[model samples]
Target chain A: MVSGHSSYVMKHHDLPIEVHDLTVSYQKKPVLYGVDLEIEEGSFVGILGPNGAGKSTLIKTIMNMIKPNGGYVKIFGDRPRAGIKRIGYIPQKESVDWDFPVTVFDVVLMGRYGHHGWLSRIGKEDRNKASECLEQVNMLAYADRPIGNLSGGQQQRVFLARALAQESAVYLMDEPFAGVDAVTEKTIISILQEMKKAGKTLMVVHHDLASAKEYFDQLLLLNMRKVAFGSVSEVYTHELLQKTYGGKLAVLSEMATEVAKNPEP
Target chain B: MKNWVIIFGGLLISSSFLEAKQIGSGEDLNWLTQAERFIEMKDPSIRKVALGALLMGLSCGLIGSYVVTRRLSLFGDTLSHAVLPGIAVGFIWAGEKENFSLLIGAGIAGFAGVCCLSLLKKFTKIHEDSSLGIVLSAFYALGICLLTRIQKVGYTDQSGLDSFMFGQVTSLSSGDIISLLITLLLIGLFITINFRQLLVTGFDPQFSKSIGIPNDFLQFLLWMLIAFCVISSLQLVGVILVSAMLVIPAATASLFAKRLKNYLVLSSLLGAGAGISGTFFSFLGKGLPAGPLIVLFSAFLFLVILFLRPEKGIIVCWLKARSERSRIIIENTLKATFKILEQKDFQENEITSLEIMKKRGLSRREVEREIDKLASSGFCTKNLSANDEANLPPQTVMILTPKGWEYACKIVRNHRLWELYLTNEAQYEPDHVHEDAEKIEHVLGEKTVRQIERLLKNPKLDPHGKFIPSITDIHQGNLPRPS
Candidate 1:
């Protein structure tokens, strides 16, 4: 298999994420249609779109949590399943069961599961790493607290600490600023900036368009398909944003629905 | 899978050929004698029954923790019911009640039921609960029909077969006990080896998948283990009540346990405790079914924990609420005293009980009780002699101690500051601010009060033109006259 993939690996080895003509649908409803993207190794990108514009779908598809209907995703020149270890995924806060019987520290320690085999015990180094990550995110004081006892912003911080514990090269965060207090939002953005300065790649799904230009270096404005992808100054225009958030193009969406009705042969 | 089937087939053929012991009926012995016999363990049959119950309890409790945490309690019930038809088919296939054959047949039926449930969810629009209902009732009805047909066929060896509905502990065989032990071992090993994986998957399947946890395989393995638990426990607790064994102990443990590991350990211990106690109770009576007794004991434990556990129990919550109410009443009385002192422009340090009663809208007797409560708690000193010397109608005059004066100043400050802030910052009407401040004053912490103080720029008076006490005045235990 290594011999077979040597050529393809040599070509796309520099890209942190490569998506070629990705299409995704949920229960016969097309969410993303024939979207393509290539993310740089150390740049911070923000994904901005309206609700139901498939921003989350694109991230989930790249993570291999949701399989695309067509095309493929490669992370560091390998399939998502094999290469996902290099990526830290911070899922939406609402996707978890807050009442689950786990403490903040326990959730963060789970980030190290991929580092060792399932049967092996967690080593002292792993524990130290987890503590350091929690300290970095300013959540060490809440390490023993049950996840349910935390406020909304504190809960988001715990998830951020967990992702930081993974120590991955690339990160994909889904709405880290949603429902967070202004102070917590500032704290999380500063941490993301620090991570980027350390040469880690990041892609965040952002809801607020007002802060998008300041927080991210590159912006991917998307609707059903990719509307624009470039530096913030290039893509953060009124016309492009209007195209992305105004609404889906009537003809394109109608055709996408038709194709969904009769899927590929 | 093929190899497993072949090995199981071989075991069934060999086991069926062995001369199996027929289950014996319990005699109507005295209660004392039965209890002593159970403890002595001299009879091999009694020993087998005891071991079977223990093993069944251990396995059910371990698997049921996952079932309850994953919200699969109803699925456990459906799977238990769905295995009944397989037991009947196994009996017919072996031409008798062979334990190995029955287990294998039940396993097959459970696997099929799971497959059907998944297929229905994947390909159709039917909800999971409806699919579970369809599978549960349909298979249970089929099993009932088959069992009745076997009875009508007049098989002489089918006398003890009806005990599968409501378990008879005396009918447990040595082979049944062995099967239960194996199931217990399998469940224990599975949970121990995959504790972290199972936890992550159960808590967040999406994140687990992203990190290469193989969530689907782990879920399938969990279902298989749950099926094993249900099948092996059928001879001890029967089908209808097995799901209770899977849910009640775990639910009881969840009341106090904050971690999954503790929850699992406590649940299994409770399961074993309920099992043994239920067996003892059944032994003390004549012809009592052990299944319902076991289920009843677990349910009773659940109710006990529900009402009596320390952290979140009903009684604890009620006690907490009661204490909070009394504290609020004390604070309000102090605030009322501060208001009376402020009305007099801090000229007097004592207030009569009649003045407090009229200010608080309470009767004279209630006012005396409040003064006595305040004095006992070291907040004030009560002087009835002064009132008597003044020729008053036996009114109690209370003098506020320094502690009392400080507390009263704090409460009044909180109330007035909140009222002022609400009127000025929140734009609330002056009348509306009082009612809200009335409640907020009792619960405001020191930190929040400081924040409010800073936000309002240390205002001197409230919206109602009342003096909002300063911190230095509160510390000094002396109020300056309102300007």
Candidate 2:
């Protein structure tokens, strides 16, 4: 199961991730407010929202990279820091410096850093797992090449392999499909699907609505709050989509128009 | 940087800007004549200077790699400059120029500068570059004013403070060496214990943070180390120019080293080598200072590497580009020849150079040059055809050899297959696919061609209905080989 925590007694009936009453603000702008959602195990849930709706910020808050002004996150019924060893994090592609002078193998090997003691040497098992992860992404042939030499798609695959090497039960990907070629998009989706089949909980921040409907079995619609969070069929409705995509100004204007049409009856 | 180069050039021009009186006033020692004595173990002074320089180079170069890779070269400059006030304050605080006090004071000032940079970024409307410039010049000016005030007070021991400008290698006390040893050991241990954390945090802070790595703590620790590195170097390369020591060796390493581990090792070696050579040259030149000369040598090394590094050097890249351009021209000419042959339905085995020129829209001479290139490469055979003696121009007819035909068919096949794949799989419009396929044709490998061929179900025609040379067509130009 790749359970990283040896001593923490993980609860048997807990959701993979439970974010309760989360509120985050950047300066004075409220990016996310009171966002609450529970992610089930083995569910490939896509967080869908328009730009500036705080999808990535929400994910970051769950990972504890950004602390919410209010509310909390519980992974395996534990604080994020205590339960993070079992979480595989794939950040946005734009977040990394591609010119960094590391080979594909070197990057994937970093996943084993958590497993090995801080001062202990990397063992044979770490090397085998790294290669196996690379092989899963069909990128073993490029293991020796510097990550900068690869194309955008190949670079994404290398990063995916690195996350795969972590072998965690929970995968948090932030816009993994952004800027990748079509073939790479398909390859990543298929791999994520395989991860889900093996009982991994996958949370992806996706921008494309059409592909979101096709890829994710569960959908979390967010517009500065928890607008909707449920099964794909339950959440991906015309009314909910219009509500989520509609801006606060548009919603206010629509409400006013309804009041004017009813003439205060 | 423009600012740095001009200053170094200024040092080279005005070499006498530093005082003629060196540290210790051992005039008439004839250091140039006694240069062979530099490595003699009998002289403890020489050994101390060499070891101090080596230690400075080792730590500066190793830490400088992190600075350069993290895009913090300018920050290093700012931090080094920011430490000046602290040095002056340390002199005042100790009432004497003690190495330990100066180290502590400079470290505090350097970190203060880092804090100012982050604070400016967070709270102010000032841009990052402007903030760096503001912090750098303001602190430096304040330190200079303090130094001048101290000089006006006329303390005899203040002579030691003057060495902080250009550095006096002869002033390397045994105590200074001890501090340097301790600094190097601490730096080495820190990097060793936290290599992966520093690397991931530097490359992708957000990802490292998301993975539960303490990115802020690591960054804070790195800044502390950089501060210490700058302070330790003040005795070897003064405050204003020490950042160059941190930048140049690491830059030279980046020119050739493809991995971070190699970059770190090579940077240290380059730093040490430059330091020793620069000191040796100064020793040979007698009254010359070592710090500026070391920087000049480092800059020289950087230029050499930029031009001559094996893989990505400008000269190598230029040469490769030239060869690749010529290959493209040769391939394009072959494709044109194949098109001409197809126009005649392969009924005629030879086409005149004038007709080829017309098809390629080139002048007669240009077409002849291309044809000659094709013929010399054994891709085609050219015949005089009796020169059409009555005509106004001489004409030569060219026929493709089997090797030429095979390559031509390969290019054409790749072009058409790509066009088909883009149209069918990628959903590119047929018209939009042609321009992209034109550029992609010469670069597609045989394996990709086979994959596309299989993907397209071996289609006979492209979107425009042009014949795509299939596997059968490719083998037609195959001939018996000697092997």
Candidate 3:
């Protein structure tokens, strides 16, 4: 399986994600500005930032959900739309409507949708894949349950199962650990570590500083812009964290506001 | 299962096309004859009207599932009203009451209303509900003005224009039927091809976009489908009641369906059923309007499902609550019996009804009823003890059977164990644990009880110094006897 995936990876650029000078603004308020990143193919990277420091915005911009005002993001040297097929995304739990009438199996099956034409039937292979993913997450017993009938940790596990079903080479997750139980958090981090060992690249938006340092091999400290990007041992220092979190960059925010008011062109 | 529904729906639609003899328009005909006439498919115009209603129902139900699921029901209503101006403009542009032009005009008007709503939401601080209200009323007023102007102008083909407010089924033409059929087909194909994409986007648009699903395009397409459905339905249900067709049947289906696939199928079926039955009732009553009757029928279905559905219906929930209340009462009575036995230090095998009445704080009559209930269920046995005093009524003595004794021990054990667990593990005061344990003891399962016992290290006594019945003691139905 590893050999097969490595061959698949060799078909694309070694760098799974590349962002150059990306800037994003929502309703004329800049969220991410002049951000640049290049993630290796098999590394686990954690994005650490304070509240409102554009962690989710950077992930969204990379997914092409929000168009950047300047610069561009490429996945495997292709545009976001084309490269996204190779990406699996786990969104924030609060962003979904739990009352939606879908079973756990149905949600997991949706992961395979990108692999087939929109009109194609979900074949036996797809069903088996979905069941396998559910089994991996230990949610097989809940395959027929409505999504609303789950606890917070169980819901996060279901999302993780869906991402596993996608079988993508790259993953972008937003706060998968938020509100989850301790066992679920451990289960998720272990699975992520296994995925990294299997040659899949992962970038996760994490809020817990302690776990962030222990979980990922590399860290990206963000505060409206990239403050530091290096290995955990190099960038996890008090000085860099203070720089990422401290409000000493009042001039940068003023510049953000000014940029929002006027276009570079 | 899905194919069966589709086939059944197709047969129902096709059955309306069968040829039959025309019935006479008799002013004095009774209700049964009118019903016979409706079943005959006799009049060509009646067949056309029936087909139109079915098609309208099918399309509205199909699109309304998405509308209701996405929380866009009000948007559907706003779009329905927003199409009036387009109808008026189409009438003026066509220089007559042309079905095709009217439908096109209404579609455009619905699209424009959606655009205006989105713009108001995107550019300003106005909330979605307020923006929907603005677009709904503003377009409706404009259309009303245009419609009144057309009437004042007095065109030759303007006779049936006012019927758009409240539908006139007699005005349905073959053109209208064909357009409704086209709309139904389009909606069916769109849903079939994009079911997963639509589901994901509706459930989570942000995630859908990340997976390369064109969230914006799908949203726009859904809006277009809604507009098409509303526009085609206007001739049969009119603008005022069209939104009801979109929402009512879907709401009824949502009450019982656990999956989106079932919800859509059931909704469309209910919509079709409502359409046929409403048209039938309107047929029975010579001058009754079909549109309002259809909406009323669907509303009736919603009420019926809301109260009678098998799992979560109001009546089911009420019955469940009633049973739960009785069970709690029975368990409480058993606990009271055990308390009395414990007070006697296991020396006595029987207790008097007067003692129970005292322990439970109940009247003599209520105690008699409780003992009777317990005896009937084989939980305990009651008998009149030999009365030495002839003047006083004989006192009733109750003895717990083995099952009853074991049950009472288990309840006591659960209560005592929970109280101990709460006071020790949950950090509750010893005084505060009894009230909570009172409620939880009846509902705690065996597995949870064992887990709590293990967590608390299998303590033998509660915080109040009461012996918690051991599992072995409960199994043996054992109580200490006097040496």
Interface RMSD of each: 1.0, 1.4, 1.0
lDDT of 3 by residue, A1-265 (tens): 0011222344445478988899899878998889878787897999998889999999988988888999999898988888788999999988998989889999998899889877788899999999999999899999999998999999899999999999999999999999998999999998999899999999999987767768998899999999988787777665667678784555435433554465333
Q: Judged by DockQ, which candidate is best?
A: 3
- Taking the tens digit of each residue's C-alpha lDDT, what string does model 3 give over B1-483? 744554454334223322111222537678898888889997787788778888888888888899888999999999999999999999999999988788888888888898899899888999898999999988987777777678766888897776677676777778888888998999999999999999999787777878778888888898988898888888778788899999999988888788999999999999998998888887885556688888899999999999999988999999999999988888888999999988988788888888898999998898888889889889999999866678878889999888888888889999999999888888999999999999999999999998988898888899999888877767664657222
Q: After superposition, how far is residue A107 of candidate 1 from its true place, in Å?
A: 1.9
User: How far out, in Å, is residue A73 in model 2?
Assistant: 1.8
Q: Which 10-residue window in model 1 chain B sums to the lowest lDDT?
A: B14-23
Global CA lDDT computed for model 1: 0.83
For model 1, the docking class works out as medium
| Candidate 1 residue lDDT tens string, B235-285 | 878777889999999989888888899989989988988888787777776
Task: Tell me the lDDT of model 2 at B366.
Answer: 86
- Superposition error at B189 for model 1 (Å): 0.9
TM-score of structure candidate 2:
0.77
**Which regions of candidate 2 fall more than 4 Å away from where they truly are?**
A1-13, A247-265, B1-16, B20-35, B39-42, B318-483
Scored by TM-score, the top model is 3
